[model samples]
Target: MRDAEISSWRQWVTGLMVAGLVIGTAGGPLVGQETDDAEEGPQQVIIERTPVQLRDPKTYSVSLSLEPIREIDLVAVADGVTGAVQVQLGGAASRQAEAVRLDSAERQLELERAKALFRVAQAEQRATSGGDANAVEAAEGRLEAARAELRLAEHRLDATVVRFPFDGKVMGVHVVPGQFVRAGQPLVTLADTSKMRVAIPVDRTAVNEGDTVDIKIETDTVQAKVETIVPLKAEFEPLRELFVSVATAVLVLENGDGKLKAGQTVFADMIPRQPVMEVPTSTLANMEEGGRKVQVIRDGFVRDIPVKLLGQVGEEHVFVSGRFSAADELVLSSSEVLLDGARAVPAGAEIPTEEDEGAGPAGRRRGSRF
Candidate 1:
């Protein structure tokens, strides 16, 4: 019975071993299938980034104009050409003395006698050699004095008519024809507005002495050449405290229409082009760190690049300089999801810095917010 039992145990043990080998062989396909599924796992989708070239918006402002104003200078003496006043202007110095007269006709006769005596002295010197050189010199001196007196009389007679000094307009007429005016009296004041000038404030860096600017007066566009760029004085009211100052620039422009009057406020915009690095307004972003910045996409990761902004252009943004290239991808819109190392989709399936035109990339589409 022991022998039989041993033989049966050996047969059953052999049968169990065979069954285990078949079962292990059958499980190989399931293990291979599980390995394949793990290798091909679900993929994550990301947004896209792109680079573009657009016109730069860097603005340099200068004032339209600061003009020179002229007031009238009145003629002080108007002796002749009185009354029948046609409201004219002349140089004050050219006018004869007003209310000036020779004191007496007897005084004139005394002058005449002095002249006769001088002539007699001349003849006496010729006739007798009484060391008359002194007498002759004295006579000549006396004759000159008489002639001066006559000239004074003549000036008094001619002082009645007034003449114009230069081309100017008369502001007012004080007296009519036959109006007797005294010396040092007021005739009419005159003003000169023939040559008009303007003063405009500008950035010291934007303009130099010879820079030309396009100026517009209402509808008229004119080219105004810079005559001077002078440092504004400390006496200026508003600019007194500002250390970075507004400079005075003188420009010569056409005022033919005379539309631009003195003291009239002018609104103007200036576009000056200097060499500066520029990026599209959309390329820049506001940072949480309290300053402006840009998104720098590199190696399929996002980077926040710091930037310094200068000003703006027509519906565009402005910056002085930056390290980014035109081919670098930037995020246009705001997103809390964007950060350093964030995964991004590109415009094209071919992942490169630059995107080819008119093709759909991995995640970029027209409907998606930029």
Candidate 2:
């Protein structure tokens, strides 16, 4: 019975195979036509390539705006003083102040005469045995009045000539030559150009004190130091006028040649000296249990590298600093099923060089690895 069963099963399998062959032969033309149609159809996939940028460690820089280290508005201290404008409209404040030395010689002489008269009155009183106290009192009153008049005269002299308080440039002169300026009236607007500074937003977390900054003003290159980090307060209240949403910091730069002027817009670069690695954000895989990671091709094998996202260049790329090699071929685009440690074949024409990476602003992207 077991032998019969085996023979019967073999016969059934042979019959099925024969029937399949017959049907396949009968539909041979139809199968060939279907294959031809498939070949003519739009089945070819066109995959565009984006090179993986193997960015080495480099100095990171931040954009900044140039401003004067110090600015002031000169005003009249005393009333009805003729404005001579000792400084030219666009001249240095330090040089202009030197020319406006106030004449206090007459006031000094008046003060000396008052002292002599007061001494004579005291001598007379002593000779008369403290009698005629009225004379002594009168003389004291006169002396006090003379002193007051001398002070007034000094103030008047100061008011007559506009003195430059610092080394700066005259931005504007509200008073004309021979113009009578009233008390508290604005005389001139001055700004110290010997050094320049910028108020950066407080959100710049990378910026710290002692960082060297580079800037360009027309044809001149200016180098400056991060003198201090000024916080929001009464003194820096003016910062609110420019950046109201975020807190700000003051970055100072030396402009000894006076190449930089207040109100002139210039670009400043705060390049850090530390070593860092920058990678494209698109190459990053996803946030897993471990951390943010990116897929790189090494020795024709896939690798998932952990990366610390530092910042974004723009919308398409990110600035990442991590343990990465400059020669690493990053997988910019890959299939959805490509897994870490799996084999991969790069489809890009060439990897991005350092020069190509510097062409545009950096950016970022978000997605999971395929």
Q: Give the top-scoring candidate (lDDT).
A: 2
List of clashing residue pairs for candidate 2: 57-276, 313-362, 314-362, 314-363, 316-363, 316-364, 317-363, 317-364, 318-363, 336-370
Error of 1 at 96 (Å): 15
Q: After superposition, how far is residue 179 of candidate 1 from its true place, in Å?
A: 6.7
* lDDT of model 2 at position 155: 59
Per-residue lDDT of 203 in model 1: 64
Q: Which stretches of candidate 1 lie over 4 Å from their true place?
A: 1-72, 78-82, 88-131, 150-162, 168-186, 189-194, 216-219, 233-236, 240-243, 254-370
Give lDDT tens digits, candidate 2, residues 10-128: 47545533332100011122112245454431121111122244433332334345777777787766565353456668876674464232334554565666566666655655565
lDDT by residue for model 1 (1-370), tens? 1459647744754553333210001112211124455443212233334453323333233344435344443443433335345443333222322322212344456556656765665565565555668776776665666667666655544444444454444545566566565656666655343444556656677778888887565466666778898876433323322214457777765445555444444434322233234455776768776767777554344567666654454355454344555556555443234544443443233332224423544223312212
Assess the local accuracy of residue 368 in candidate 2 as a C-alpha lDDT between 0 and 100: 23
The alpha-carbon deviation from the true structure for residue 195 of candidate 2, after best TM-score superposition, in angstroms, is: 0.9
Worst window of 10 by summed lDDT in candidate 1: 21-30
Question: Candidate 1 local accuracy as lDDT?
Answer: 0.47
